[model samples]
Target: MKNKFIKISVCTLALSLLLGSCTDDILDEQSRTVYTPDYFKTEAGVIGGLTGMYAHLRYMYGQAYYYNATLTGTDEATWGQSADGNFKDADLSGVGNLNSSSSRSDVLWNTAFSNINAANGIIENASAVGISEALVSEARFFRAFDYFLLVQTFGGVPLDLGSGELKFNVSQNRTSVRNTVPEVYTKVIFPDLVTAVANLPDAGRVTGGATKTVARLHLAKAYLTYGWWLENPNNIPTYPETPRTDPDGHNAQWYFQKAYDIAIEGIDNPGPFALQPTFYDVNVATNDRNNEILLMADHTESSEIFNGGSLTFGSGGAPDNFAGWMLTWNYTSLVSGTTPAWTAKVSSVQREAAQPYGRPWVRMAPPQGVFNNTFADKVNDSRYDGTFTTVYRGNWDKTTLIGTNPVLYGANGIAVEPGDAIFSFLNEEPSQPIDFSNTTYNSGIGAGVLPGRADFVLPPSRISRRVYPGLWKLGPYRTDNAGGLGQPNAGSTRPFNVAKFSELYLVAAEAAVKGAATQPGKSARDLVNVLRARAGKWRYSNADNAVFIQDNSAAAVAATPAVIDINYILAERSREYFGEGYRWFDLVRTQKWNELAGTYTICGPNLTDVTPQTFTRTIQPFHYLRPIPQGQLDAMDMPDADIEAYQNPGYE
Candidate 1:
């Protein structure tokens, strides 16, 4: 009644009926002020309950819980010193050190359950009020979404489907007993989602809201994860030490076919969906709710939500999207001025507007392994440039002087010449061996020839700690409104994409490799080529036009392994979905968690300095499933035996 932000208690539902009686009186003021389980039986009440659940997601995504839990344990990123061991126990080599007491884990588990519980309320009370099938289906979609994340993270959890009455059963809440991963999927996730798919609106749902196709997209992904969970060829509890074994009754082919069929339906069904012609076009701020995104978590700058766009994580401001802030490079650390002395345009009124660009947290960075190993042709892969900002031309106007004296443009003065190459990130690290004559750096200041020295590339003069390449994909939109002179708390307002239609291509390709059904006139090769061809077109047509950005021809597709193996598909995903928080789940679902984590040399800025030189710890098999948050285990009102039984296998 009072806009559902008012927190309700679980005990309220269980005791609601007991507080009611067969009495009719004007003294029933309690009914107007407080919500009982019976309130959810009404249409307005059901909608309020659903709105509260959605609002919780907005808050949860704004927090560090989801990204911290998912991003660190993968190959793409590592827990840097800035995080101060936030997810370190889980991400580091001493896998056994991670126990049930981790606060971050506690945050993730509790936040998700809040949404799951809210969905249960809607489903249980819908029939009593005769709620529409579509609305109930929306509630089911959210329930399945929460359970999907739970099963993936915790393996098994209490399967609570409110039976007949909204008792909020204390026993169900208190029990630490866990279900099997398969049981959770089959019993809870699959059924609810199937109901969601059958009953949700057929089309034209809002971008951030649940639609039939959105349900189908997740349902397909569930099938894919299920296929791998059964007889996971790569699931060696201890790998290299232990041999890979295909478990009995692993009908992977069956599940892959089911996944392939569903994915193809989503892709081929006549609807408003197609891959954006350019990778940049797909993710830019103007395209926040574009056709490419099947589902995304929406955020706004005006709302008192999280952190602002350009400002780093801890700086005081209203709630803005901190995801971009966390991944952004420490811009303030780069330049040598207290008050920013650089302005690209001479007559600019917002001359000091460039200050916000220096406000990033620089918490995490993309692993160098991806640039070297995954991007076989990063120069031509439109995604590389679309995703990363490799060059930083000086925006400081020449007239600005430093050191309380007149400083000129050249020789130690703080003036940027018109053609200066302020920052450069080579495709290959300088320490690695390479052939000299043909090697060239696309410094955006013409070709940079490799120097004679073997220790590093480009003189050490250009290789300062401040020159690291920041990810541009999640950058704060630099519009006049957003990039105003003193736009306080102006940070990211972009939607965080949860599912994209382009990912379906990769899914379809992987399913095809695993002996599943394929789309008509579309092989795995064709699907990958479509994306590549789009990349090639963008490379040639875009403004950053340099000769190095070549197109992927038919021959390139033929040579590529996307037509043959899973490794290339994983590699392509690394290229496409870098900072979108897709890495951990992608690696886990594919069973490549241990292998890639062991193989790749992930590096980040050192603890005391901004040098991109710290290496990550090797990953272990137990990392396939995140340890149950210690707080959950401590909070559960159960015996030690039940807690022990419920804890995932390797975490103990």
Candidate 2:
């Protein structure tokens, strides 16, 4: 009888039913509220169940541990100084092992199946309740969405979740069987998305809701990924051990062409979505949920109950948008002197609710290659500036540590006010030598003093695991705090953007690069240039903390090679969507994981350890697909050999 605004806990009992024996360990408590098949036949139950589908995204997207699994081992990131087993294991560099127990992909494993079962319940019964086909399509989109994620991560996940294939299950069934890659895609993901695209409305039913455009985007991506799976260019092994052949007898090229066609169609049908004028406008905290973002795991600052997590503090668990914190170094550790002679030290960069500063978990750090190779052209590209928090400005005035002193002594014994730059991560090595030996003026966190600047600086080469440029794109933003830091410890309220309109271009370009026939002006090069040109325009400089207008679209376009390849597309994707959790999937899809991220360079974990060291990852063939979660294996009431067969090869 309640509306969709009811929390996920009250709407569905699928978590317990789907996981069976694992429920006691995974969920806090078995949900007392159970929706019968008959319950879903009612209008209230159908609406509330649909709401649960949208609400499930929080359990995976913004949760920091899962975020680490997606990017930490890739070329984009590595484990940070404060990393525990969760972060270190994901790096695959011998610090820890990525077993079924340790893999953070469990975040998806634990959350998605329950949501899929819930979606099945809604899709089956909502039609009986006279729900509009458009409304039911939302459930279809989510079902397909989860399957797409599962097939990519675990190589052949169970589509039959205690029910018949894609059917709603009322009773708990512990035994499970894995489906083949082609079976999962052909039977579940592709069909549901195709139906969703046909029946769904042009505009989203609600804010951040599934729509025709979003469904098309996922379908195109699904095609692209499956095409890669079929090609298996690197001869990577797959679970369930099925041959790389489409059930429909379509070749890899057929899927690639379909992917390109659908992505371009989605781009043409711009319903309430378009690229932001400049790339900077797309990610600036104030501009979140803008037209460019097609879908996101929605969060709110208005109500703690509805937000699904605490507004003032976060536990860094599921349903909390804390992914931003992992890439954020402990900027609060940066110290400044209260007097000009550098007598007493104070925390200059206090944690704040503003865009650049948030609670620091320090679980992940970017490698030096991110600066030296990926974002090498720091001059014309606005993305490098928009993506990283290079400048740590003074906010000691907000803290009692500065007391009566209005200014703090920064680099070279220069005075800096409340808003002045206290420390900076230089885009390139300075012409004037940085004095790392000046222990008196050097920031304790591996920062060195430049001659004239008030801010201590770290060149790209000196960036270490303990201190690197924080991810500015995904940082916290809050308006509730008037003067003081407002809940700096709370998870970010900004919607963790899952899909963007700009990505449509990247997807289409990738498909074209993989031998898809190109349209007249829509070749791989043209599609990539669309994003590169946007990267050249800048309205504001995040590093300078001031208005900066520049348009080098000509230069950016000119820089693109005459014939672009998959490696170039990957590089462009990194430049465009860096630190937003796309790296691992990108590398895995192209089978370039070991090739691109085999060895990475970064300074050691300690503050004074500035010399770069290269680390190697043992990226065996089996590492392409993450291991199935141990909890899932433990829940299955199957024979030992059957269970062993169910797990991915190396993880067992």
Candidate 3:
């Protein structure tokens, strides 16, 4: 809050100058010239105005470290990393922090709002100056997008609809708590998106590209999120997370249909926006700015500068130095404990698999006794490869198992075990299973090992043989995949920080499945297969494909597809977007948030076993709205907001 002017608030200052006729005064001097409202009257200005909104977002997301820590890691979820207590202490109380806007801690907060302000400014002034009519829609859509981030992250926030209000109400007591999810959908989210759909020009709506289609995508998302949030009193979607029960749940169907309607309308025809169908070049280190990335903020330049570290990751200054789970743990790339070296010791979760070496720090694993078989056996799961890659030829061959091979190596690789002095606190390991030709136990004599046992019992050292064992190399991080597994030790970029478009696809796919779109098949079952096939999963089509719609309902999803099932769709959302921080909000929308509500633990294997999941909130039916900061809450009182309660009002 100290340097509120640091990039974010500077947005307000810049915008104010635009609305008033005093813009010429700001440009009074030629050398110290400032681009005023009149300046943006040109094509460059129009582009720059849009660019300004986009610039705020580019500085916002995508560091494997941040993705892991905040989204999937202990920062938000109860992934195993919280087991020992290293990060996100409040969320993972013992290890996380509040005032430490350290990395992207508040990036989502400031950037989203700033972008929103800029967007509003663009919309407010673009029309007055006669900027392209198309640009106005794009601006409005983007402004809505910024609002989406705010609503999703902090729940209901003050609605700053236009550039007219000249009030400095940044103080807490100046606003209200939690806007109705419906109100948000009807007003801010829907209007802008609809305007986007009509006014967003024909800007070559490429795959990763933004255009009317992108507007449609978010609108669909807004509908789905809104319905799901209000599905139940607690915000726990009507759907259940386990084995997919009651897939239909509430008015999810109605919303899903609307989502689909918009998606189809945006395209007008199928041929154009069809997926590019090219395989993901997993080798592309970063800068995955291809058309594949739909609706993303432009971070192409930042994405390409890949290395051992980023502003999103690190500890005590050495930069690249990190904790392991950053790659595989938190997000649904894999469950921890399943892969040996990538155990709770490596991540904090027990069931998630550990990435070979594409390490971030907050590796994802599951609870102590929970086996991630649901996720592990998804060999053909689309998210699998997107999350972690397959490295070896055969399955785990138990007999020749050493504790060093990557998770992909057959036998001869590291054997799995439970956490303890022998394993990790998360408990449990790979069955160290053997490929069978009548129960074969070897990696055929020349095989490898698992998480490498050198540090099997150590206090989590970085270079432990067991820690960086052959298990890592066998992963998508096979830095030498192009070298055909022969060359083992080159520090590779692609081999680090595993990422896949699968996550977003699933988001889109489910959006479709839930009636959010008009893909060829209206059911999620087919989409599931599409994803599974992409992950190289075995023939995903099941006997139930015919009855998928019927089998999938609010009460049950037994391989049927007679009708769309939102809960089942969500189950996939969970499986596909796990650890990606999808659950945090998914819980809210589906109204199943109570599953993660109340007291929870961050449990870690390195430090204390349990840490509380305390966070700032507004009130019941308003819990999703985060509390206003105490200082701001106190300063702005009476006439507007409830200053007294707004000041860190959680205790009451």
Scored by lDDT, the top model is 2
Regions of candidate 2 where Cα sits further than 4 Å from its true position: 1-32
Q: Is candidate 1 or candidate 3 better by lDDT?
A: 1
Q: Any idea what lDDT model 2 has?
A: 0.87
* Model 1 lDDT at residue 497: 70
Tell me the lDDT of model 1 at 93: 49
Count: clashes, candidate 3: 112
lDDT tens readout by residue for model 1, 128-218: 8888878888878887887788777666665642222212322334443455566667766888888987887755344456777777888
* Inter-residue clash pairs, candidate 2: none
**lDDT (tens digit, per residue) of candidate 2 on 512-534:** 99999989999999999999999
> Model 1 off-target regions past 4 Å?
1-36, 60-62, 94-96, 161-173, 236-250, 302-320, 336-358, 395-421, 429-467, 478-491, 539-559, 602-618
- Each prediction's total of clashing residue pairs, residues at least 3 apart in sequence or on different chains, is 12, 0, 112
The 10-residue segment with the lowest total lDDT in model 3: 1-10
Q: Which ten residues in a row have the lowest lDDT in candidate 1?
A: 20-29
Provide the RMSD of all predictions against the true structure, rounded to 1 decimal.
8.0, 2.8, 12.0
**TM-score for predicted model 3 compared with the true structure:** 0.59
